[model samples]
Target: MQNPPLNEILIGDCREVMKTLPENYISACITDPPYNYEFIGHKWDNSEIQRRIEKVSGKGNKTLVKNIPYGSGLAGGVRNKKWYQRNRHNILDYEKWCFEWGEQLFRICKPGATVLVFNSTRTVAHVQVSLENAGFYARDMLVYKRSSGIPKGVNIKQQLEKKGYEQPEKWDGWHSCLRNEWEAICVLQKPLSNNYLETLLEYGTGLFYAKEQFGGFQSNILEGIQRDKTEDFNVHCTVKPISLMRKLVEIFVPRLENSILIDPFTGSGTTLLAAKELGINYVGVEIVPDYLEIINKRLDGISGLQGMLPLSE
Candidate 1:
């Protein structure tokens, strides 16, 4: 099949759109799907807090409150009500949905294509199970550590104090949950042929660029700060930093001149932008029309990004 013109964002359900493309056309996939954690806060929420802190401190504000009480003070009423209805299903149902999409993803990728999926720590195991059940080989897991994170859960010490009970000094450290500082990215691959070199020659997939990884070797842990909402970039709530996305793309498609990357859940087009910056072809599928608008604006702002066209085009 002739390579289709990519570098465009398709506004529709990914499962439906992926079916229209030719089989084994995608070289690699790097995407971040919903973790089924209900209505969890994203990078935009955190950035708002940082903006407020800077406002009070004037500049160079390093200190941040250890904990912020839920519903007490925060933007959007301390929680994302929009996400509440979407993630009401239980874990079992969520995993089943994961399997449905995983099967489709496996069908579209080449023989030895790579797939990198980001999930919350709680649901990483389920995601792995879904992918493995869909016939993708389980590779090593990658960890992305963030420099800052907001801790959530009930404060036992504070509750006891409010109830007029004298708690021991050692109880100061007690809480229902710990601060989340990292997220898990499950690495997976389609089964390759016995001879890797022959597989690469036939399918144009099957190897990782060892030398292109950060610091020579590709460690499981990738450390980076989150992307803040700047004048040119901020559109989605859970936007990842371009630097991190670029690294993942580079590792997946070392020979970018002939490869095409697919982002199934292209929120605000961060992955697409990364592909454009690296001078490669890409296809992004977004369900929300609002997000598609954001993707268009972002792509338009990027200089020298060829094949820039509207969704209708």
Candidate 2:
């Protein structure tokens, strides 16, 4: 409630931690929390796999798993014992948990505040319903186009053929199956008694630079920074690029100089780091202790940030 000592991470459950904060304390909330999908938890190393990539052939190629932070990956295999337990039972359980948090978030944010929630196709509809029920109006959906890279050594098609499976002669985009190239970013706002669109439009129009760079930005969706993040722990859980958040804040809330940006489920604190870099104040809440530590270390590494006890110069 006492602002939790600026630039420091609060390591605890968001719902409980949020209770210590004042009502309408933040100007905006941007986050990508756990979706109910029970996403696989390990990264796939396809370096030894074969590929027939054509579209991205001319582009600067980088290995999909290279340079990514360790400990983050997809969900699959029995090794994900802990994940299986946490996400067992009915699918609705996950959605219910999200709704509970959504309500809490709505209560803490200022009126006319913006909340950006990122989710997958499997859970986007449920998230939409949850946000609406929480009293926030659905504003836009931003889409980030990604390029899935190929592995180096093994022959996946050949392996399938050898197994007597029907393998297609040509491979289409990743999404033709279950592989996703873009994620849905649901934007919501706590409406003002009067016209809310004035501020909404002002925020939307401000993202023109990113719109122009990534083509035109859409109210419901927009393109994202193209990169492979399967190896990055902070990015492994269907995370949105910091670049995207940077653009969104820069365009929609240019005067963050005096506003507080809150991310209740601050996984790796990407939003917090972005806000500090942009000279905007921020408060974050994370359910995992290690994640909070990661954010603290990240903030300490930021040189321009002041009025905080940074671990490093």
* TM-score computed on alpha carbons, candidate 1: 0.77
Model 2: per-residue Cα lDDT over 98-148, one tens digit each: 677788887877777778887765577778788788888887777756556
Which residue pairs overlap in candidate 1's backbone?
Answer: none
Where does the lowest 10-residue lDDT sum fall in candidate 2? 43-52
lDDT against the true structure, each candidate: 0.73, 0.60
Cα RMSD, model 1: 7.9
Q: Which stretches of candidate 1 lie over 4 Å from their true place?
A: 1-5, 39-89, 168-170, 212-215, 225-228, 303-313
lDDT of 1 by residue, 1-313 (tens): 3655488888777778887778787888999887655323322233554554555475452333222222323312435764344334445677877888788888888888899999888789988998899999998899999887766666888878888887545579899789998989999998887767866877777887667334677777888656655545454546788888878877776454557789998878888888877766788987766677778888776664344222211
Worst 10 residues of 1 by lDDT: 66-75
